[model samples]
Target: MNKNLRVPVGIFGIFLIIAITLTYTLNNLFYLVNFLYIGSILSIGIYLFVINNKYGRHLVQFTIGLYMVIFLGIILQENMQLSGFFYYLFLGVFQAAVIHYAIAKIFGPVLFGRGWCGYACWTGMVLDILPFKTPKNHERVKNLGLLRYMIFILIFIGVLILFYLNVPNLDYLMFIIFILGNLIYYAVGIVSAYILKDNRAFCKYFCPITTFLKPASYFSLLRVKNTSEKCIKCNKCINNCPMDVDMLDNRRKRKNGTECILCLECISNCPTKSLKI
Candidate 1:
């Protein structure tokens, strides 16, 4: 077996376990289909990444991102946004957005790092398509990163307020909020990309989900590590990274380490093939 194939296979196996377990426990086949589809796409993307396909990551993004936004959010009216998660949480419903947050946004990062941002997030889906791929570290606004936590807290408080107020037509309102939220995210993400000259500007500066993701992904098992022997003092990896991760510094506490999305841009750009997951 090719060494590069191992990670994809491992991810596929893990997704299968999650899918099967959810299906068995929930007695709903939707869990099986949903997870199986997600797992297959992720495995395929990782495999293509191994084969050096430039579109490999984009393939997964479009596949999963479109489904979540179009099928789940619009067609099904599931409201998979951040508000939706809190909505379900306050309602004590263990379905839909809460499950997504638990599995993808929160706990999953411990295993895959910020894979959600890289591969599955609908917000990132649109942002990745914009012209700026690499980050403009120089132009990054100071203290703007604090906005993410603020946004996160505001959203939480908003949801809690709604719960306290006992709003009527809650389901319908959530669906509407889902649509509005996506529009706002797209608008902000795109403008920020152009303004900051960084495609991931919104992610780095304003994504509230990072509040959950960063803490757990700080201990991610899968991340890029560089071997000093093959490193020729070239800074290609750092220069190419969209998220500005200091991947060459192999330490748990490396600068911007938790920000890594496991995108492998650093790995492919390495001149001596020294970087790997």
Candidate 2:
């Protein structure tokens, strides 16, 4: 939320305002609405790279807000065909796109990492704003983390099997299943986080996005690093991590956790400036 970033952020906001207004006021040329929407999405994506300030996080939030509004518009379309229904997938894809870009700048770790997750994701947003207590630990189920890859394997196999079986409209079914999968996956993550007292336990184990994104994030240009020289071993970073990553342990071991989201909560909160990047 640095003051310097405000101007660009404000400009981006204004662009979105204009786009929405055009869609509503210029109904005669509604096709332009999609272009306007894409423009806004691109603006928000670039805003992340423009402003290193944490306030850019809200760009992600606002994008989702815009997406949901447009999603309802699409869903409300008259005579909407199944093809039209598929556009709903854009909601998730757009979020992924934002993260994909953000990670690219930060040197890449998907699943929205700490930057996009803390800022843009509706599910993560809800969890962050919730008036409740939650734990951040994976020690109990750390071994189970491998299950996500297996889940991915099963999903891939299922898609391949359906294709081999000559399933009609398999693409449509796959799209539907993908949409359902995101909803169910996030729902399960949120509910499980509530029950298990861990905010990202399910993300660490069950989320296919995390499964795929984690590796991609590993190869990403940007990554979280520990500046252990200043660490006082306060353990705040570890305790505050939504993904249950033990930053202190990583620092101690001279390693970075693969699950690190680069959320910067650790860096911002670190009294010693020991946790950074």
Candidate 3:
């Protein structure tokens, strides 16, 4: 096998394991099919990326994002949002939303960092098409990240209120929230992108999902590394990074390291090819 193919194969194998395990444990064929579909698409995207296809990441984003947002969320009425995760958790149901959160949002980050944000996020799929792929201002706004925490807390509280009130037709309400929440996210994300001149402005400042994604991703097994010997200090990697990660630092605590989506812009932009996963 070619060395470059290893990562994509490994990714597919991991998802295959998850699919088989969940199918057996939960006695649901949907788990097997859903995960297999997602795994295949992701593996193809990674292979395209390895071959230096510039749109590989976007391809994955649209395929998986549209499936989750349109098929699972709208057609199946599964919600698939933070509110839906909480609702399913409260009901003790190990369904689509719960399984998705567990695999894609919570525990999965320990291995892949914010790969979900880069390759599979429905919100990011839309945002990445915006004009500002790289922020005009290379620095993040001070203290704006606190808004994610606030939004996280508010979602939790709102879910609690629904459960406490024993809201009738709770499933319907959650589905409604899912639609409205996505609309609001898209609206705010687009507006913020233009205002801040950054495509990921919403992810940086307002996404409640990051509150779950960042901590585990800090210890992610996959991360970009820099080879100092090959580096010419050209700073192209940093300048090209959408997340403003200090990829040259080669430390777990590197500036904005937790924010890295493993997008590989730094590697692609490196003049000396000093950066690698």
Candidate 4:
């Protein structure tokens, strides 16, 4: 078997394990189908990426993003947003948004890093199509990253307030908030992209989910590695990174190491093919 093919196969096996485990533990067949679908699409996308298909990553983004936003969020009213996670959590419900957050935004990052941001995020799926695939200024805005934590705290407080007040029709209200939250995310993401000339401005500066993703992702099992022998110091990889990760340095404590989303833009642009995952 080709070495590159191992990545997708390994990823598929991991998802299969999760699917089976969740199905058995929860006694719900929905988890089997849900995780199987996600795994299949992700495996296929990774396979395409290995074959050097330019549209491979986009394929995963669109299929998974649309399914989450349209089918889960809108049609099924699952409210898979950050607020929805808190809502389900506060109600002591282990299903729906809580499960989604656990597997995707929380513990899962320890295994796959922020692959969700790269290939499965509904918000990122939209922002990626903007004109700035790479930022005009490679330097990140000073202290702007602090906004994500503030937003995280505010959302936590907002949910606590709702639960404290015993808000009526809470389920329906969560659905409404989910829709409005996505709209606000899209608006802020797009506006920030144009203003910052970086397609990932919202992710870098304002996404509350990063508060969960970043901490665990510091120990991600999967990450890009750089070969010093092949590196000619052309700086193309750093120049192309959307997340400003210093992937050239293989150390775990490298600058912005936790910010890596596994987008592979750095690898793809590496002049000497020095970067790999």
Candidate 3 per-residue lDDT, tens place, 1-277, comes to 9987998999899999999999999999999999999999999999999999998899999999999999999999998999999999999998999989998889999999999999999999999999999986778899999999999999999999999999999999999999999999999999999999999999999999999999999999999999659799898999889999988798899999999998899999998998878
lDDT of 1 by residue, 1-277 (tens): 7888888899889989999999999899999999999999999998998888999999999999999999999999998999999999988999968899999989988888899999999899889889999975734578999999999999999988988998998889989989999899999999989988899999989999999999999889888898658688688999999888787789989878898888888888888989877
Write down the TM-score for model 3: 0.98
Candidate 2 TM-score, true structure as reference: 0.60
Q: How many steric clashes between backbone atoms does each model show? A: 0, 9, 0, 0
- Residue 273, candidate 1: alpha-carbon lDDT: 88
For model 2, how big is the CA root-mean-square deviation? 8.0
Q: Could you arrange the candidates by lDDT from highest to lowest?
A: 3, 4, 1, 2
Shift of residue 57 alpha carbon in model 1, Å: 0.4
Q: Pick the candidate with the highest lDDT.
A: 3
* Whole-model Cα lDDT of every candidate shown, in order: 0.89, 0.51, 0.93, 0.92
Highest TM-score among the candidates is held by which one?
3
Regions more than 4 Å wrong, model 1: none
In candidate 2, what residue range of length 10 has the lowest lDDT sum?
A: 76-85
Q: Which wins on TM-score, candidate 2 or candidate 3?
A: 3
Worst 10 residues of 4 by lDDT: 227-236
Give the clashing residue pairs of candidate 2, or none.
Answer: 106-222, 107-220, 107-221, 107-222, 108-220, 109-217, 114-261, 224-277, 225-277
